[model samples]
Target chain A: MLSFVGLGISGFESIPIEGLETISTADIVYLEQFTSPISESDLKKIQDSIKGEFKLAKRWLVEDGNEILEMSKEKNVVLLAYGDPYIATTHIELRARAIENKIKTHSIHASSSLTSMIGECGLHFYKIGRIATIMSEMKSLTTPYYVIYKNLIEGNHTVLLLEYNQDKKFFLDPKDALKGLLETEQGQTRNVITESNYVIIASRIGFKDQAIVCGKISSLKETDFGKPPHTIIIPGRLHFTESDALKLFGKCIDEPFDNSEKTEKISNQMMKKYVPMVREALEEIEPLYKNQKEFEIILDNAERYIKDAEIFLGEGRDENAILSIGYADGLVDALRLAKGLEFKM
Target chain B: MLSFVGLGISGFESIPIEGLETISTADIVYLEQFTSPISESDLKKIQDSIKGEFKLAKRWLVEDGNEILEMSKEKNVVLLAYGDPYIATTHIELRARAIENKIKTHSIHASSSLTSMIGECGLHFYKIGRIATIMSEMKSLTTPYYVIYKNLIEGNHTVLLLEYNQDKKFFLDPKDALKGLLETEQGQTRNVITESNYVIIASRIGFKDQAIVCGKISSLKETDFGKPPHTIIIPGRLHFTESDALKLFGKCIDEPFDNSEKTEKISNQMMKKYVPMVREALEEIEPLYKNQKEFEIILDNAERYIKDAEIFLGEGRDENAILSIGYADGLVDALRLAKGLEFKM
Candidate 1:
């Protein structure tokens, strides 16, 4: 039988009571720390608590699960990891393989920093959208940038996980990640990330020296957040209670504010620009076709569609709104072209 | 000083090692069961483990918080709750208030069912979008319906938390919530939910009797999911690995497939219909103005916009695609109307 146990986020002391017993009684235990590094002191304490043969598992050993599966066939084995074990896709795949091989498998879920940091920052967990990871080797940060944009438009907070390479003992600095996002903003121009945008840098969470430093991106450009294993959170709309909690929960260099305000949805952006433009174009052509009978119907249709576009937009039917405005603009511009005037579309 | 400790997803046996110590050494410990009900046997075990004064806290006591804060001012007080302590917004608010009252606060983060259940179901945690709660008293399920729609369009999973009332011992049945979504689909025709859509019902997770039953809505209609504290998961796009793990992890009445395939983005839906309609309209109007020099540019521009719309749609610029197609349709309709034909828009 194979048991997958989580060490939770706080090193040795945060493992669940059941997980402790599982590890102690197992014939062989493999502790994998590639996802997140463990402290040396915690490592010592964990070794002292286990009565079984403890072996440190590398990333490759867990990824290539032959040895673990073979050992679990005859003896009780526990594979422990940082955070919740199955958060890593590799672990889930291994579990599936174990089941396929007819080896009974058990899981002991523990604390994950993904969910903990949000509460530690006093942010509501339900408001968090899809999370994104920023790898240092990525050619561009556009994927994570657009993720933040989508989450912001929906008034949902975004949790950005920076790269952690345990083999290299490397961690992406929060400052560098922020800089990459700003650079992405220059190319994307969706107003997702800006200098004045509020962000929180939650470092070493679930540890005694955990620090949460937040402020405008500009203010944090020079600030150094100590230690590794940091996460960046770009919050969306904030309730008053959330704002109060945030102010008290972390070191905020600036007042807490909504990042979603500036990042408008694409539908809204198109409606804002096209609605008035189409209306003005319709008015311009309406006067030109005052006496023309055939053109009169086109102008009337254009006017009605302009009104319908606004109503559709108000009803949250954004695609319908854009379509209506575009059709109105087309109607007015066709009249302008037939009249030998400059087109407005 | 006051401490907020998480009991994790399991019963008393799942409490973190640090959490156990925190509760045993505190002068007073208040175990709040309003968030989730604890088994009587587990409650008895918890009482036996805590050497301090143990008190059962109701929802009102935790929300009011005044009495707890007063006690913490002079004594070592601990507030224990199921799952992660800070997952409940009320706990966060209380922690903030504690800080405001000049009291020191500490948090022992543990396993949150929110993150754990995703892994248990073999779904990627990063793909989870903003979660929503469905209550029996809600006038309409439209809010959560739209949330599922939005998450589906983004290819993200939606975690629907069923309402749990500790005082009334009431839990919203997963079938009722599914039925409400189906009813919502009748009024709002977004193809977000249908009888064919796949869903997973996770019940009593982290307990010995935990069950993960999943299939198409029709397949699950007559199925009985045994207990309360159930959560419904609507998966979006499915990676092959996720499908494999899900099938291995749960009881599937039907084959696992992508729920997102049927739920197309509104922009894509619009383009799918409008692009061809506009092209046919343009083709019909082309011969009418073949020789007219003044109308030549209108026909040419319409053809160009139609092609541009398709290009933009392929590039994932959905708003631009909708705008360009709408413009093309308007151009075609105007020409058709001027030529004594009925408008197609």
Candidate 2:
């Protein structure tokens, strides 16, 4: 039989009661630290409490799964991991493989920092959107940048997890992660990440020295976040209650503000530029073709479509709004093309 | 001091080891079952194990918080809750209040069914989008219906939590929730939900008799998903490994398939209908202005813009695609309107 147990977020004591008993009785217990590394003192305590043969499983060992699967066929084996065991898809796949091989598999789910940290920061969990991880080797942070943009527009908080490498003892600093996002904004220019944006750095959650610091990105630029295993939260819309809780629960360098308000949707961005540009182009062409009866109808239709576009945008029909404005611009520009005026579209 | 301890997803065995110690030594332990119910056997085991004074904490008592918060000032108080204590926003709020009242507060995170059921169903946790709840008294399921639509379009899985009223001894049936979504599709008509869509029903996860059943809505119409605590999962895209795991881990009456493929994005949906319609409209206008020199430019530009729309759409610029097509349609229809023929916008 194979058992997957989680040593919750806060070191050794956070392991579920049943998880403790499972690891104690197992013939072999493999502790995997690739997800999140445990402290040396906590490691010693875990080892001292275990009755079985304890082995530190590397990332490849768990992923390869040959020895663990083979041992579980005869001996009672437990693969103990940090956070909820299955948060790592590898463990989920391993469990599937065990079931496929006719092995009885058991799971003892424990606290995960993913679910724990939100409450720790006093943010409502239901408002969280799809989480994105920032890797140091990525070409651009565009994917996660857009993820935050999308979540922010929808009034959903984005939880940005920094990359952690246990083998090299490497953890991406929250500052570098934010810096990458700011650089992305330079290229993408979606106005998603700015220096004045509100962010929260939740450091060492569920640990004895846990700290949450909330402020604008500028305020945190020089602040020292003590340790590794930190997460950055970009809040979208804040309820008064949430703001109150955040103020009471964490250290505040600045007042909490909504990041969603600063970031405009792609449709809104286009409308802002094109609406006035189209109107200006139409004004220039109207005088040039005033006496031409055939051109007069097209000019009138163009103005109507532009107005309709704004109304559609206000109604939340974004695609239609963009389409209307684009059509109106095309109409005006077609005349500009015929009259040898500069094409505005 | 007040400690919010979680009982996790399973019965009594799922509480964290430290949580167990805290409850045993506490002067008062208030077990709150409002989030989810505890079985009689588990309840008896918990009562027998605790040396402290045990009291049942109802939802009102916890939300009101006067009694528990007042007691914690003078005694060692632990508020025991089902699954992760903080999954219930009320518990999070309670903890916030405890901190505000100058009482020390601690939390023992446990297995949340939110995370547990996804793993149990062999779905990747990172692929999940923002979660939504379905209350029986909700005027309509539009909120959850749209939540599924957004997740499906992005190829993210959605976990739908049903309403559980402990006071009334009631839990919303999975079928009823599915039915609500189906009804929503009829009114909205974005093709987000249908009878042929694949879904998974996860019932009593982490319990001894945990069951995960997957099939199309049509196939599951008469299927029995036993027990009070149940959840419905609407999967968007299926990676081969996820599909393999699902097949091996759960009982499936029908082959699992991606619901996202059938539901086109709103832009794609419009393009499908408009591309052919615009082309047909352009064809009709060609015969009327074949030799007219000035009118010929408008016709040529309209045809070029129509083709450009398709190219832009194929390149995944959805908004630009819709705008191009709408522009083309307006250009063509403007010519159609000037002529004695009918307008085809």
Candidate 3:
């Protein structure tokens, strides 16, 4: 009998109860190390938990001719893999060999990285297209960039998992990954990862220290995203609520402007053109109120319009903000029309 | 804060370690009854383990209104669900609402029916395709049959999960499911389910008293498969080694005819027509052996061929059996061809 067990994501605690049981009961256990590596502490814990001796095998043990076939002939063997057993193609080939040798085989499925932690970033599962892995030395590799570019063209959100080295403590952050993607796009004449292109960077998923930060690709270069096992998400289209959530929780237009002091000096010149329009509105509304009775209500109405306009402006929608500003201008026009009608004063 | 927890497939022991932690930390825990149900003992164990009150809600709590939303405002509410949190659409909708309302939501994913104890049955996970649940009243429902039909047409194996009623313990057995499928196919113009269709019926899966029986779906109707929580699998295609494994571990097939009881009646029967062919092969091969030394080798070869032919015949391969019989015939013809070239001793 051959047993395939998924070690789950995160650590040994993440493994399903049944998966743990299968590993403990197996006679000969072999772990596939290519898909995802378990932590050394977790690996030691699994060895202590299981009765059998666990052996780690490379991709060649299962793929090479007759190794798996000979072992599967008589003795009971168990193959340990990260995430779900059938998630990788190596396990699939091993299953086909076990079937060909007439050996009984079974698999204990567990939570895979593909499906488990994706919900943490608030991305819909069905909307995800092709998944790509970005390496640190990716300039020599063109395949990964092409996959992400093609998936984006199809209007499907692409999830790019950045590679990490635990021993070296060198992990590729989302900003670095976006930089690689930007370089690739520039070379290909595709200006997708621009300063305005929104990207979501999620760090330490499935852990307590998990963080989700959304911003433009250019702005992410200056952001400090802590920790490893980061994933970069490029959203295809934003729903209304998603856009609102991004504005509220994520970075909007409140980013620091470098030329704010210089812009303040020119504020008087800009204000001169709009002062007459502002003064005319203020003059028209002063007489219409006549008393402090309706003053609070009018002020509240104006406050709501200003708040709505600010939110619209923060989303990089100057035209939509103009519409709201026009609504506030109509209120002033109505006050002017009311004053011209000769109200009881 | 709102937490979504998966209860796993089995009783309380089946729940993941992380799920137990979420339940202990939650101020208010609510279980959705539609997706999965918990045993009374397990539910009581959970209630005793946690300090908070555990409440049960129907689909309406997740879908209809913001009852969960209203409770999660100030309380650290946790929603207990069956399987993984995102497997069902209701949980996904609930999570989306929690995110929209700015309520912090966490998901503790666990094992599901999709990862049930399939290892004991000796079936590979990659080989199994889209799963279909066989309801108790399958006679009135066409959904299960259609799913099975589609899976078969797509050349994928289907795992049929027999649904059981918690109140009445009314579960559909694998034999009954097979009969239901056969009847459904008969009702249609196509006769897909035959006496030779290989079906695997596993009863009491994940339990110690698990039983796996592989045979024709028609033959399984008569076999006694004890206990509940049965699963039926219909393999689309068979590889050579899979056929061998089935012959070795699965149910045995009865012979076509018996000649030991009445030799006189067998001699006069239509089955006697093949006796001459068997005799001619034995007579020619007997001449090749001058003593027991040569006769032993010929007898061993004949015995092995007969065993292989029997396995093929039992698997409903009369055509392949005829080919084996022809090979035995060729052995006799070779002896005849050799005898013609030799001088009589």
Candidate 4:
């Protein structure tokens, strides 16, 4: 039988009581630290508590998984990892492979930093959107940047996990990741991340030295996060309670504010620009078509649709709103084309 | 001082080692089952372990919070809740208030079903989007329905939490929630949910009798989920490994499949309909403007844009695609409106 156990996020004491017994009784325990490294003192305490043969399982050992599966066929084996074991897709895939090979498998879930950090930062877990990982080698941060945009438009918070490569003993700095996101804003021009945007950096969470620091990108550039395994959170709309808690939960260099106010949805941005332009074009061509009876209805319909677009936007029907405005724009521009006037679309 | 502790998901045995020690030594422990009820046997085990005064806190007690905060002014008080502590916003607010009142607050994080359920059902945790809850009193399920649509477009799984009213002893049945979504699909007409859509119902997760059942909604219509604290999962795209794990980890009435294939983004759906309609309209009107040199540029631009819309949709620029198509359709319909003929948009 194979058991996948999580050490939780707070080092040794965070493991579930039942998980402790399961690990001690297993014939072999493979501790995988590639996901997140542990401290030496915590490592000593973990080793001292185990009664079975303890082997340090590297990333490749867990990914390769053959030796572990073979051993589990005859002996009880536990593959222990930091945070919730299955949060790492490697562990989930291995569990599937074990079941495919007719080996009985068990899982002991624990606290994941993904969920833990949000509460620790005093943000509602339900308000968190799909998470993103910031790798050091990524050609662009557009994917993560757009994630923040979508989440912000819906008033959801975004959690971005920094790259932690155990083999290279490397942890991507939160500052550099923020820098990358700001650069992405330049090309993508979504205004998702700006110098004055509020961000929280959660470092060494669930540890004695756990710290949460919040500030704008420019201000946080000079600040040093104490250790590795850091996460950056870009908050959207903040309830007053959340704002109050954030001020107390972390060291905020600036007052807590929403990053979403300045970041408009692409649809909203286009409407803002096109609504006026279309209305102006319609106004210009309406006088020319006053005597033309057939075009009167088209102009009237265009004006009505533009009004409907604004109402739809006010109701948060963004797609329908865009469609209305686009139709109105098309209607007016076509009239301009037929009349031999300079066209605007 | 006040401490917020999590009972994890598996009753008393699943509590973190440190959490157990903290509760055992505290002056008073408030066990709140309003969020999720505890089994009688599990309740007995928990009461037996606590060395402190144990009080069963109603939802109002936790929400009111005045008595707890007053007692914690001098005593070591613990607020024990199901899963993680801060998942309930009331607890987070209470903790924040405790700090505001000059009382020190500590939190012992534990395994949350939010993270555990995904791994338990063999789904990737990172692929999960913002969670939504369904209540019987809600006028409609449109909020969660649209949330599912947005998540599906991004190919992210959605975790739908069912309403559990401890005061009323009511848990929204997974079947009913599915039915509500289907009813919503009729009026919304988004094609986001249908009887054939794949879903997973997770009941009593982290308990010995934990069950994960997945299939098409119609296939699982008669399924007995057996207990409360159930959660429904709507999976988007599934990797082959994820599908393999789903088969092994749970009972499937039908083979595991992707639910996202049928739910196209609204923009893509629009382009699919408008691209051809506009092209056909353009072709019919070509002869009308064949001798008109001034209007040729408008017709040509409209056709080129219609083609650009298709290419843009293929490139995954959904919003841009919708805008371009809308512009082309507008251009075509405007010409059609000027001519004495049937109009198409």
Q: What are the chain B TM-scores of all models?
A: 0.99, 0.97, 0.61, 0.98
> Candidate 1: where is the Cα deviation over 4 Å?
none
Whose TM-score is greatest here? 1
Can you give the DockQ of every candidate in the order shown?
A: 0.88, 0.59, 0.05, 0.74
Local accuracy of candidate 3 as per-residue lDDT tens digits, A29-138: 78776655567787788888788767877767766726656775776677887766665655655666677677887766555555555455444444454566788876
Task: Per model, state how many residue pairs clash.
Answer: 0, 1, 0, 0
Score residue A313 of candidate 1 by CA lDDT: 90
Full ranking by DockQ:
1, 4, 2, 3
Ranking by TM-score: 1, 4, 2, 3
Write model 3 residue lDDT over B1-345, tens digit each, in one string.
888887655556555667777788888888775644456787787787687878887666677638788888899899887666665656766777777788887777765544443333334443444466778664443666655554454344567777766456466767767777667766653344555566777665433454667766556567878766667776654444344444443343421111112212211221134325544555555756566553344434444544554565566443334334333333333233334422110
Better of 1 and 2 by lDDT: 1
lDDT of 4 by residue, B1-345 (tens): 999999999999889899999999999999999888899998998889999899999999999999999999999999999999989989889998999999999999899888999998889877899899999999999999999998998889999999999999999999999999999999998889999999999999999999999999999988889989999999999988888889999998899888898998778778778888889999999999887976788898798889888898898777677777877878887788788667686
Please give the distance, in angstroms, between residue A245's alpha carbon in candidate 4 and its true position after superposition.
Answer: 0.9
DockQ, model 3, C-alpha based? 0.05
Q: Superposing all C-alpha atoms, what RMSD in Å does each candidate have to the true structure?
A: 0.9, 2.2, 29.9, 1.3
- Every prediction: chain A TM-score: 0.98, 0.96, 0.63, 0.97
For all candidates in order, the CA lDDT equals 0.93, 0.89, 0.57, 0.90
* Cα distance off (Å), candidate 4, residue B27: 0.7
Ten-residue segment with the worst summed lDDT in candidate 4 chain B?
A: B336-345
**Chain A TM value for model 2:** 0.96
| Predicted candidate 2 versus true structure: per-residue lDDT over A1-345, tens digit per residue | 999999999889988889999998999999999988799998998898889899999999999998999999999999999989988999989998999889999999988999999888888888888899999999999999988988898888999999999889899999999999999999978889999999999988889999999899988998889888999999999887788889888999999988999898888888998899999999998998888777778888899989999999998878889988987887787677667676776
lDDT of 1 by residue, B1-345 (tens): 999999999998889999999999999999999878899998998898888899999999999999999999999999999999999999999999999999999999889889999999998888898899999999999999999999999999999999999999999999999999999999999999999999999998999999999999999999889878899999999999999999999999999999999999989988888888889988888988889988889999999999999999999999888888888888889999989998888
